[model samples]
Target: MSHYAARNAQGHHRVHKNDPEAIAHLKREHHKFRKLVDRINAAKTPGAKRDIAVELHKLLASHIALEEELFYPAVKSRGLADEVKEGLVEHDIQRFLSAQIEAMDIADPLYGTRLGVLGEMLVHHIDEEDDEMFQEAKKLKLDLDAMNERLETREHQLKAQYARTGRIRTPALDREVRARNAV
Candidate 1:
């Protein structure tokens, strides 16, 4: 029997056959991201806006890394290649916009507009992932508990690396930023 089936036999019926813990973690992060964006939008001072933007950027960078490195790969291995590819493309767009936003002064007129656009894009992306990709992953019966533990470990490692370097780093995003800077 599958891990989930065995667990269900023990009355853990709420545990999904896939990775419920990982999905819950992702959902929590999504909620946090939306709240952070809302806080950014409501900020009245330039300093407040800048601080919130930095927080949002860090959260987004880490969240993207978690999904791309672990969750998406697991999904793809389960035959969800198209969803994974689409997600990566969206992450690229988000990373590009994040870089642009990071370079902007909070006082700049375009700053708010750019932030708004990013928020909209993120909302749409989150909705699609939660509704479609996650649903597909569930049907594929992924080992979500193991994946969640891996994601947690990776997130901590990334956070420590960021603290040491003073930058939110993800391999793919770092390369993309470097390429953009080169040109």
Candidate 2:
């Protein structure tokens, strides 16, 4: 039996270890992101590349919001503060790069270069979260099934909101915009 199987056999596996819905959802998102990255890299025409980039941006923005709003808080509450903090910083970096890519003309040579760099950064971030952070989270006694339900609901709401507004409403960004409008 595997280590996880053995742990479960011993009745020591956490709720997340047994039923990892939130983690599963995050992994599915990562897989989709990876496929989109590959498509972006293989795009032949500038228009195709631009279209894929927009799709990627929307997908990643929603994914980041899901993590920041739900997954990160759950993990952080379980004593994974460092990983959550690093993940937030990485998200900021990705947002900056994504905005830069969006501003550049698709025909520009640097556009592809920036897209490639963003793909690499995304891959690295995904690997770290999947390999290290998720493992750590599984060890904790978190109610992952509840977290999963919350994430799923929020993800659906965000997608619908995006469909209407064409942008992800991140909490931080919403707060910032609200504060600015109040001035």
Candidate 3:
């Protein structure tokens, strides 16, 4: 079974009641990110790895949109400006690596190396985000349930967009890109 399908069959463990709902939601995505990395490692053939890579890219793109569009901005507004900036930079690195990975065939000599590097980076990024930024956000006293609700809606919209076009982008990220390019 697919990692996600297997997880669904098992059902989610209960999250702590005191945990921020938004953070809980994001933690789940982070878990999936790690699972996809495992899938890459376990894939015995290039074709299988290629399919997993594409799925990971779609999910990562949408997940990044969630953070860039809503989560980080909300945290930054609460005075964690430096943390938010750092998170955005990490995301940019991930995006750059993902683009390169997509352009390469799994049969390429460097394909596994590059994918492994990206996987390592993702694991590091996820750890920092979860251990540092998320912990801080929980203490920032944002409206957790409301944030989770919006994140849920955004996820649905992004999934729908990907279903229609096989890609995802957000106006929030578009504006950010434009601003950076204008400089």
Please tell me which predicted candidate would have the highest TM-score against the true structure: 3
Local lDDT at 75 for model 3 = 95
By lDDT, the better pick of 1 and 3 is 3
- TM-score for candidate 2: 0.82
Candidate 2 backbone collisions, by pair: none
lDDT of each: 0.78, 0.78, 0.80
lDDT of 3 at 173: 86
Model 1: residues >4 Å from true position, as ranges? 1-19, 172-183
lDDT of 1 by residue, 84-152 (tens): 888888888898899899999877988888887897788678767877888788788778877899999
User: Which 10 successive residues of model 2 have the least lDDT summed?
Assistant: 1-10
Candidate 2 structure quality by residue, lDDT tens digits, 80-154: 999988987788779889989988987798888899899889877887887789889988998887888998898
Overlapping backbone residue pairs in candidate 3 total: 0
What ranking emerges by TM-score with the best candidate at the front?
3, 2, 1
Error of 1 at 76 (Å): 1.1
Clashing pairs in 3: none
Regions more than 4 Å wrong, model 3: 1-15, 181-183
Candidate closest to the true structure, highest lDDT: 3
Lowest summed lDDT over 10 consecutive residues: which window, candidate 1? 1-10
